[model samples]
Every structure is written in C-alpha cells, then in structure tokens.
Target: MADRPEVEISYDLERIDFERTSELIRASYWGEKRTDAINRRAFDHSACAAAFIDGQQVGFARAMTDYACFAYLCDVIVWPDKRGAGIGKKLVQAMLDHPDLAGIPAFSLRTSDAHSFYEAFGFEVSRDGMYMRFVR
Candidate 1:
C-alpha cells in the first residue's frame, strides 16, 4: 500500500474551508439537519480544528468553551473518503492542545457510535446519560 499523505491540523478559523466543513457535518448523523447558516454561526462562536491533506480540507472538529471551566467538543467529522486515516484523531488532539483550551477543568461530548474512538483520548462514557466526559 502507498503511504498516506501528511495531515495538517490547524486551529485557525481563517484556515477552515467553510463549504467543505459544512458538507461533512451535514452528512453526519448528528448534524444532518443543520443548516449552513447555523453551522457558520457555530464555527464563528467556537474554537475549531480543521484538518487538511495537501491543502484540501478533509476533517473538522470544534469546541464550545468558556476557556475557563468547561468545554464541549462537537461537530467532529471527516470527509467520507478520508475516514479511518487518523485525521479525526489529529483534529481532536489539536482542539485539546489548543492554547485557549489548555488546563480547562472539564470536557464533554456526545457520540452515539464512536465511543471507543473518544475513549482513546481519555473520554469516558458518563453514567449520567448519553454524554461522554473527560475530567481533569
């Protein structure tokens, strides 16, 4: 098999490809009903991590954070053709490592089918309900 191209993860909103990011999110089970305007608003208010391969946007993830006490990770998606290539992991890591989010007390996310994926990053299934949490 050929080697995969390097994936570049960026937290700069200016680096995001809005159209492609919206398309990937809208295709996800969680964001299927989200409108372009809503997605744009969300990205505008959140800290985003966008992944690129050869300068083409391929994955995205964002965190709604107060940058103080808590953060909620959401809208994580990778282009269909790019899934399983570790781009998603890189995006999430970028979000977690982002200077704005460093040392936050808690982080949470909701994922119906990707529990194990998130778990690998230290997120645990919350006994409280559908959310998974990573507490520091």
Candidate 2:
C-alpha cells in the first residue's frame, strides 16, 4: 500500500463547479467530450466526494446510490501530476465514507488501469459480472 499524502479529504467541492471539474477531467484523461453529461449526472446523483489539496480539487470520485444497498463509483481520476502519490486512494476512501454512500452492500467501479490501486480498497473482480453500456 502507498503511503497517504498530507492532503485533506472532503466531500464539499464535489461537482460544485462544472467548468472547473470538466477541465480537470479533460486534462487528466485523453480528451473525452462529456462535460455536460458528467455535470448532469453529478448534479442528478447529488452524492459525491472530492479530495482537495489546499482547497484546489486535485482528485474526484463520485457515486450514485439509492442510500440502501447499491452504489456505483464513477469518474474517478486524479490530476496527472498527482498520480502515484496516493491521491486517488484518498479520494476513493473519501467517497466511500460519504454519509450518503456509507454502508452500501456493494460499491463498484470500472477502470482500465490502476487495478492494484483499487484493490487496495478491497475492490475485486466479479467472476460473472459484466458491464454493457447502451449509448443511446
């Protein structure tokens, strides 16, 4: 396990500013055009957590949940410069600890990399689970 950074974990800055968050995500990822959609989901879900370094959003992880037994962690990314420094883990931990997200029977995510990183939080592969995205 990587050592945690000295940054503070928070759920307040989550999706607060779409323009800013969108820019951060776009810069971190390989130029995906989904800010409007991301904003819509973030606002619609109304339950997310973010990690900030000195009040600046360096990492973000969000979850959509029924406050019961299901939750999906989505759009988890940390700034490129912040990668490999434990910020992502901190952000994820913060989201899982959010008052609206805690105690869910299951929390899930899909990632192309960072399997070991996510596994640090006890996330494991489901032998029979598969995700199908309907883009209509």
Candidate 3:
C-alpha cells in the first residue's frame, strides 16, 4: 500500500468543519444527536482529530483527556464510503499520537462492535466481570 495516496490527519479544532462532523456522528448507530451548542462545547473541550482527503472531511475521533495520564476516546467515526480505505485506523492513530494523550497510561472506549479493530491497537477486554458501572 506504499503507493496509496496520503490522507492528512489534523489536530487543529479550528480547522474542523463542525457541520460535517455533526452530521457524520448523528448518522452513526452509537451516535449522539446533540444540538449545535452542545456539539461546539464538546469540540472545544476535547482533543479532536479529523482526517481529510483533498480537503473533504472523511473521518473523526476525539478524546477527552486530562493531558496527563488518562484518555477516554469517543465519537470515532469514518464515513461509510471511506471505511475500507484505512481512514478509521489512521484517525484513531492520530488521536493516540495527539500530544495531550501520548504516553497516557490508560485509554478506554465502549463499542458494541469493532472489538477486533481496536484490539489491533492493543486494547484488551477487561477480564470477565472485572468492570462494573452505574448509569442513570
């Protein structure tokens, strides 16, 4: 795949096109349908990475991190048409490499599917029954 064209992954939130990103997430199965105000606020507080091909946004992944030891990766999505092109993998890599997140001891995400995709990056399922949670 050396000859495959390059896709630019960027961490500049100001360069992110919010409308496109919102639409991308809203269309996903595990997506949040948030208002523009809420979405903007989330973007403002999170370390966001987006993948662009020739200037069109095709992928996104963001992590809420303390810029120190932990990051919770969320809202990872790649446009369906672009899925097989390695954009999702590249976007996740960009998030992991973001300066605030690199070297963090722990990263966590919840996915009902795509386990193997993330496992390839060394994420392992918690040992059976090792995790407990509460939600309202």
Candidate 4:
C-alpha cells in the first residue's frame, strides 16, 4: 500500500457536486451515462461519501442501506487521474464507518475488476447461491 494523500472524506450531501461525480462515473465501463436528475435521485436514497483535496471533489462512493440489516455499496468511483492514490479506500472506509450502517448484519457490493480492493476491507465473494434480475 502507498502512502495516502491529505484527502478529506466527507459525508455531507452539500459537499457532493452531481456534475463532478457523474463525470467520474461516466469514465468507467461499469458506469452508465446518467442524467443529473437520475444521479441526484440515486444519491438522495443512499449514504454517500466523497474525497476532496483542497476542496476539489476527486472521488466518491455510495451505499443504499436500511441502516439496520443490509447495505449495498454501489457507484464507487475515483477520478481517472487520481486512481491508485488511496482515495477510494478511504472513501469506502468512511461509508462503512458511517453511523447509519453500524451494527448492520449484511453489506454487499458488485464489482467486475476490483475484487482485491474490496477484499482488503473484508468483503468476500458469496459462496451461497445468489441471484439478480434486471428490469430492462
């Protein structure tokens, strides 16, 4: 692991800028080209964390949680230029440490490429049968 930069992790919705977050997401293959309204609604329903350097938003992660039993982390992203700078890890730690998710029995997320990253935080691939259906 590399030394983390002096980045501030914020859970404040006011500190989240939709355009900036969407830009970071849009750059990734797992991200959809979503409109601001759509993104705003998603954030509205989720617990979100963002990383900033000199007050500039550089990374973000969010989770939809009942704050009791389940949390599904989604849309985790770090700006392309800032990848590998430890911002993503810190952003995730902030989300998991959020008061809303404390004592939750289950937390899960989907990732195609960052398995090891999440594993470092104690996430594991499910061994039991799991299922999903997309309403397309």
In model 1, the clashing pairs are: none
lDDT of 1 by residue, 1-136 (tens): 7888899888889999999889878888898999999999999999899899999889889999998999999998888898888888898888888889988979999988889999999999988657999887
Cα deviation in Å at residue 63, candidate 2?
A: 0.5
At residue 16, candidate 4 shows an lDDT of 88
Full-model lDDT for every candidate: 0.90, 0.67, 0.79, 0.79
- After TM-score superposition, what is the CA distance of residue 78 in candidate 1 from its true location, in Å? 0.7
Q: Candidate 1: what lDDT?
A: 0.90
Clashing pairs in 3: none
* lDDT tens readout by residue for model 4, 21-90: 9766766776766776778888998999988988999988998888777888888888888988888888
The lDDT of model 3 is 0.79
Q: Model 4 off-target regions past 4 Å?
A: 1-4, 127-136
Shift of residue 47 alpha carbon in model 4, Å: 0.4
lDDT for model 2, on a 0 to 1 scale?
A: 0.67
Model 4 TM-score is: 0.85
Error of 4 at 97 (Å): 0.4
Best by lDDT: 1
Evaluation by TM-score, superior candidate among 2 and 4: 4
Over 1-136, each residue of candidate 3 has an lDDT whose tens digit, in order, gives 5565589999988788899888777777766667677778888999899999998888889987788877888888887888888898898888877877787878888777777788788777655522211111
Q: Which of the two candidates, 1 or 2, achieves a greater TM-score against the reference?
A: 1
